[model samples]
Target: MNESLNELLYRSFDTTLSDEEQQRLDEGLKQSEGLRQEYDRLKTMRRIMAEQPQPDFMPGFADRVLQRLEDGGDASGDAQLFFEALWLSFRRMGTVALLLLIAAISYNIGSSDNVSLRSAFNIPETTMEEIIEPDFYQELESLR
Candidate 1:
């Protein structure tokens, strides 16, 4: 029901409960059915654990883990080399693609018979009539 009661109950299983803690735990178990049930469960668990054999690890567990890490370090270096080669391949492909695109555009511009690249983008040529329009002179005279 409360932390103090739970601690007392656990301590009791461990045979470490003080007289005051034991009294408190006994009063709590008497007052609350939940506390009594939890206490029984914990006591059974403690007894089951005590009855079971302790676990044993193989020797050199730490050494085996270190060995695995050392082995994995080589794999990391190989992965880095693989990624670097992939990036270099992509860069070379990009440069070749750009060169091919430029060559294709140059060939298209040079092979065209109708309009040259310069003429296609050039401003329209002005006629003498447009340059010497009477309305333009009138506007200029008005501005002056």
Candidate 2:
């Protein structure tokens, strides 16, 4: 069976080709010199990349990671301590902010005067008194 182009290239490197195939490849290579040059460049780049060394890191990276684990990190096992601290601070401040807002609104609404609800709106004092007190309203209902 005839081999695929990739299989033919793989066999060309790690194994010996049959004399017929070798002659055929040589004729093709002679016809396209650019292909042969590109193949050589790719082979050299692959070899160089495989041989390249990894970069070194700071010495304390592992120690800092272990320290974070001891401090109770989350599921991802990293950044848990920092995130938890930030979340707690925000939660506490948010609760305080809501409480302050509630207190301010309560004070303002309780103390503010509305003309529509006052005697100045042309309502009599008796009507204003009934509007201000539930006991007065109950008495008026019983009289009626």
Candidate 3:
């Protein structure tokens, strides 16, 4: 129940006591039979735990867990599946948009007047004097 005894007990478990702390704990253990008994019990428990064989896992344990996640067995897998679904939906929407664009273009072309391919390439003839008028050149000279 004493604060120092409690601290010493915890320090003993941590194995981080200085010489003075060790001496204090030793003195307390000598003075209190209950503290001594508790210390012994803790030591025995520590020893037992240390002596026990570590549990062995099945082969490819990590690989199996990763595989399960990939197969949509865990939260991460669910997230992956969610992203995949989102991607598929986006792809479908994109395809629909492309088809709509193509349809619109086709409709516009079909509805337009039938102009000959040669007529599209025919540029209207214009004289340079007509393009740049004498009046326009006079305005430029005035600005200068």
Candidate 4:
């Protein structure tokens, strides 16, 4: 298709074309078989569309659309609804994670001699070599 006259060809169907544009479109159709087929297809489509009756909208179409627009305008509301739905879906997993955290904290506190929050989480000061040695577990077991 010739880019220069393609727009002119489509325009000739909807609006009156100038003599110069019509001549250019005619010359293009004569030069390109493909363009001529496209022109024929457009003409057939326009004729078919013109023959069909215009479709009517359902009753209350405007009211329904306006109601939807009014109800769906809040972005924050939509986000909050999505978050609430997500929380509902994963509440069981959240419960399990919370239980596990509490159990871990309780175990740490019970294992500490001091029974204080600081002792429950504190790491004993030790050289890196002692932590890596095989005897570390044996020494820790003996202390217990």
Which residues of candidate 1, in runs, are more than 4 Å off? 53-144
| Candidate 3 colliding pairs | none
Instruction: Tell me which residue pairs clash in candidate 4.
Output: none
TM-score pick, better of 3 and 4: 3
Ranking, TM-score, top scorer first: 3, 4, 2, 1
TM-score of each: 0.35, 0.37, 0.42, 0.38
lDDT per residue for candidate 2 within 56-144, as digits (tens), equals 78999989788868867454544767788889999999999999876766665566564344423333446655566888777877898
lDDT of 1 at 128: 51
> How close to the true structure is residue 140 of candidate 3, measured as C-alpha lDDT?
74
Highest TM-score: give the candidate number: 3
> Candidate 1 local accuracy as lDDT?
0.78
lDDT, candidate 4, 1-144, per-residue tens = 777777888898889988888888888999999888889999999999889998889999999778868888565677889999999879978999889878887888888777676665565757655767768866767787
- Stretches > 4 Å off in candidate 3: 59-144
Candidate 2 vs candidate 4: the lDDT winner is 4
- Indicate the TM-score of model 2: 0.37
lDDT of 1 at 44: 88
Q: Largest lDDT belongs to which candidate?
A: 4
Instruction: Give the per-residue lDDT digits (tens) of candidate 1, residues 22-138.
Output: 778889999988888998898788789889998867999889778978887465577889999999999999999999877876766666555665544443567654778788877
Model 3, residue 130: C-alpha shift (Å):
68
* Model 3 agreement with the true structure over 76-112: per-residue lDDT tens digits: 6678799999999999999999998767666655655
Q: What TM-score number comes out for model 1? A: 0.35
